[model samples]
Target: MSSETKSPTPSAGLKSNLPSTTTFITGHNAEGKAIVLDSRPATWKSFENGVMGFNQIYTNPFPPDLNGDADLHFHDDKIASGNLGLAVKNGTVCRMVDFGPGYVCMMHRTQSLDFGIVVEGKIDLVLDDGSSTHMKRGDIAVQRATMHSWRNPSTTDWARMLFVLQDARPLFVDGVRFGEDYGRGTEGLPRSGNDD
Candidate 1:
């Protein structure tokens, strides 16, 4: 495996071969019950800057040989390959996303309510109003009707986090969400074209 795939595993208060003190969450959730997810520390300090473990996966819509760092990063950030997403509701979703080491998203506006939980590392978030704030692990912030962008004021360390967002007017292909190519028009979801 490549170095990118060789990430340290936060297990039982230890990483790689280093001995440390920490807590790892291990549990599941039932449909009708309130799920209080636990994200125990991998040690006294095991922050991915912002990267959380949400069962990351990648899907290549082309030939398989396009597996490299540059390609992977593009897929991870743009195509959202490395990012793992969990559906919270029809208009809300959860994802483990990376902001960066020197991450820049050129200012943009998003009409959504974002509730972020810092899982690892740190972030210096810049809002549309030019307001900024620093966020660290275990910290949570709420962004409402805000035009904003994210930055990791660090040079050597990247930022990661668990983001829970509710789309104000999220685009949908059919009766679905994000990446409107799923279940909708031609080459879309497997719908019978019936307006229910």
Candidate 2:
């Protein structure tokens, strides 16, 4: 169990079976034309253990940099936040995640409202209050910055889910604002970067 372990890199012929693709569009040259920025296949970063799901297929560094009026308006792939999710303050993120059989993410919470859709297979959404719901394909879930976790109960099948995370105001209770809690080091289990 070494923290120095490296994650799996995608090869030339290795394509993920997940059906997720992102099409980026941006403004063009002085002619004021609309152009396609990058229309390549979606990239997947496999987990080091090969059992965890993939995270952050694409990221827009600045969510507020929507207009091309800023000094830098493009995405930067080199910025790594260590947390696999691409959520940013006052911005939005689009990501596709997959969970293999018997995989259960630890309970965690972020300051974002997540809109998730079960694209393939089935998964159980467990809440902080111990309430759990079984979600299947075509099911849409709206998570409102609440503590939760995902569990894939299937023994032989994988579950693919698409999520759109939008930065939101921090949850306030009793006049105290609590920030995000990733809740690492649970159950003596190792931390997985794909927890989102």
> TM-score, each model?
0.43, 0.71
What is the C-alpha local distance difference test score of candidate 2?
0.63
lDDT of 1 by residue, 173-196 (tens): 467543311211123213211111
lDDT value, residue 139 of candidate 1: 87
RMSD in Å for model 1: 13.9
Model 2 Cα shift for residue 66 (angstroms) = 4.0
Q: Best by lDDT, which number?
A: 2
Runs in model 1 with CA error above 4 Å?
Answer: 1-90, 169-196
User: Highest TM-score: which candidate?
Assistant: 2
lDDT of each: 0.44, 0.63
Per-candidate clashes come to 10, 0
Q: Provide the lDDT at 132 for model 1.
A: 89
